[model samples]
Target: MSQPQQSTVRNRLLKALTPSDFALLQPHLELVATELRQPLIKPNEPVKQLYFPEVGFSSITTQGSGGKVEIGIIGREGLVGVIPLLLGSDRTPHDHFVQGPGEMLAISSQAFCGAVNESASLHKLLLRFTQVQYVQTAQTAFVNASYQIEVRLARWLLMCHDRLDGDELRLTHEFLSMMLGTQRTSATLAVQALEGHRFIKAQRGRVTILDREALENLADDGYGLPEAEYARLIEGA
Candidate 1:
């Protein structure tokens, strides 16, 4: 099969910009492909460019005395690295890594700041996206604390499938375990359970959702809705 097209026709945020406003920043927005399992930004590193994902998703993961856990994820639904731009944050609080392969429009920190400063519309749009992202971060915390492992696993798979626009996903059990903050054996068992239900099919490293509705039902109440809310807020903003 031929390679998927890795160019942006109109990213959600970019499309929201007035034609003239988009024109001002278009030259600075460089298109790049995200490699599987690659770290876009590391912990404690300086924030460089702002990435607006045109496809796939990136995980903002935090690590400490306990272990690593994904705090937030961004796809075409939102942009990455907005905290530094909004708060003047210099040190990275988490690692930013691509969870799946996709296209992104990247702009230098200087250029991004300039774009936000020059266009009031752009500023408002980005800030609204920021608010939605904050909600997601909060919900993820709740899920981590209160939800069962199977529920969380189902939620994560639904999320990955949503952003990729396909059921088939390229990810490893090790990676899934890290994202969910679960033991490898537990994660393996969760995958097995989903497979048995015919909600998903798992191989060595990848997973393909078989019945999306059943998977959504299995996620209980901690998933799906938050992502839908993010989309609505962005659309109405």
Candidate 2:
């Protein structure tokens, strides 16, 4: 298997690692492809591999009384399977899976934990992401509770847009319902609302951004805090 160097990796988390810390992990990191809906962390199952996606993203979801609710999004800007480990657990109650197909640099949890235990700097750097998740989840909860379906949809789209490279998002109404924790009909109506405003143009299974700034305004305070927190903690690292 080919090992990827931290300097050449697009994952912001890997890129943020110091050279010494990177060296500790360089030997173990292998390039791998993650397929859509492929399970990474099954609820209550041990998280054996950690992934730093170079492209695409994954959804960290949990069971809610209503059904599955997406709590966080992990992409090139973040790492997967780190939360349970950072919190001193081998497993988590959340389901983590690929939302889209992409290549990622993956390492075994054993090697990942060993490197973190060996380097205080590495451990500290990775831990900042844990804080970023906390903020993101809290923001998600607040937005879900306080905002209208249109507003909530806008917030969700904005988050997805942040982790992607292009303006078009490959998403369906049912998929969006799960992400927003709303009914499918609600999601469709919201999509129409955004399209009505020319904020986005919704196609069969794709949505293209027409005016990102307007969507941001519609999302308003529902967005930006967690992103700012990520910038302050992870990017600044």
lDDT winner: 2
Q: Each model's TM-score, in the order given?
A: 0.91, 0.96
lDDT of 1 by residue, 56-166 (tens): 789999996768878888877777887767666765778998887887888788888888889888787788778877888888888889988999999888877777877
User: Candidate 2 at residue 47, lDDT?
Assistant: 90
Single out the weakest 10-residue window by summed lDDT for candidate 2.
1-10
Candidate 1 structure, TM-score to reference: 0.91
Q: Which residue pairs in candidate 2 collide?
A: none
Backbone clashes under 3 angstroms, per model: 0, 0
- Model 2 clashes, total count: 0
lDDT of 2: 0.89
Output the number of the TM-score-best candidate.
Answer: 2
